[model samples]
Target: MREVTLTHRECVKLIGSPERARYGMVSVDGREPRRLTCLIVGDGDLLIDLDRERPIERPIAGRPIAVEFTHHDQRGNGGWTVTGLGLARPIRDGDKPIPMPYTTLTVGAFETGVRVCIARLTGRRTRPTQI
Candidate 1:
């Protein structure tokens, strides 16, 4: 029997479009299997997607992700931010949590290949008068 291969590029394609319901699976050396049905649009600006089958449930769902990030903003004040992104699911085991902005998860074909980063959600800087 051949195993199903899900690549990072495939996940990226799913994120590019505006739709709902994608089928995939997550696997690891010693752990339970997880299935993912990522909904890209809906649930506000944030992308609603996750693998619910994890033994330990995480509150990652409904979390916001940065689609387009900007460093600065207009009037040289606060930056324009947009939070909402969708991507592949994470695969790992053992109850452990780190206090970092992002989590490096073991996923897909590469070792240390999958990175769940909390990117900055900022828009391009514009002059206040433009607003």
Candidate 2:
């Protein structure tokens, strides 16, 4: 379970293209983690289409967030995890909550978030456990 730092190239490789999508762990303002997935698309900029069982009413337009994508090999092979940073508008700028049902809320506490620019990514190599 010892975490290891990965190079830029390694990070990109682990996070394959859109075709090879997997869920990532997302947390805003160090809150609880939620499940989300998206393609690497481009370098340095990460955009997440966040989904929740229920809508959130807190302000998140300009809140700092963290995301982690992980993989574990069941056959004793080494696996890795990637963590990234994000950005958004001022929290108060878009504090108003977005109405639910059929509305697209961007840069708020309900729907989408600003581009998560992960300029640099670190890695965590997973150690296989003995059953």
Candidate 3:
């Protein structure tokens, strides 16, 4: 486990590759991390979407969070993992309301109301290991 500092361009190149799984695990307040769908990967952060497990639960903006993304694809090769710390910011539409993007999955397309959040990386470390 070594810390590899990646430039913005390098981060995009490695993370944007199709070989990487389109999912990440995110945790807040030192709680157990949960799997989140990777919505969009930016130069310094990622847009993640998740549903509230309970009606009254949701991670608020400005909260600290930990994120992890890994590579896993058709080749079945052992992949690397990128872990980082970030802050969560809920996506807002200028005070109008949150916009739940219409996302389509294996089943079909539907506008499922989900909590969209941004994990703005403050620090990151890379792990290169073989299975």
Say which candidate scores most in TM-score: 2
Tell me how far the alpha carbon of residue 93 in candidate 2 is from the true structure, in angstroms, after superposition: 21
Q: What is the lDDT of residue 32 in candidate 1?
A: 48
* Prediction 1 TM-score vs. true: 0.23
Q: What lDDT does model 3 reach?
A: 0.49
Best candidate, lDDT: 2
Q: How are the candidates ranked when ordered by lDDT, highest leading?
A: 2, 3, 1
lDDT per residue for candidate 2 within 1-131, as digits (tens), equals: 45567877777778763333456776777888887554343563444544432333246666776878887777767788888777644323333323312222222242443445565777767665545
1 or 3, greater by lDDT: 3
**Could you give candidate 1's per-residue lDDT for residues 1-131 as a string of tens digits?**
12233343433433334333333332232234344332222222222223333432454332332243222333455433223233323324311123211323222222212223333222232334434
Each candidate: RMSD: 16.5, 8.1, 6.1
Among all windows of 10 consecutive residues in model 1, the one with the lowest summed lDDT is 94-103
Report the alpha-carbon TM-score of model 3 versus the true structure: 0.55
Number of backbone-clashing residue pairs for each candidate, in the order shown: 2, 0, 0
Pairs of residues clashing in candidate 2: none
Order the candidate numbers by TM-score, best to worst. 2, 3, 1
Which digits, one per residue and each the tens of the lDDT, describe model 3 over residues 102-127?
Answer: 34422111122222343343324444
TM-score of each: 0.23, 0.61, 0.55
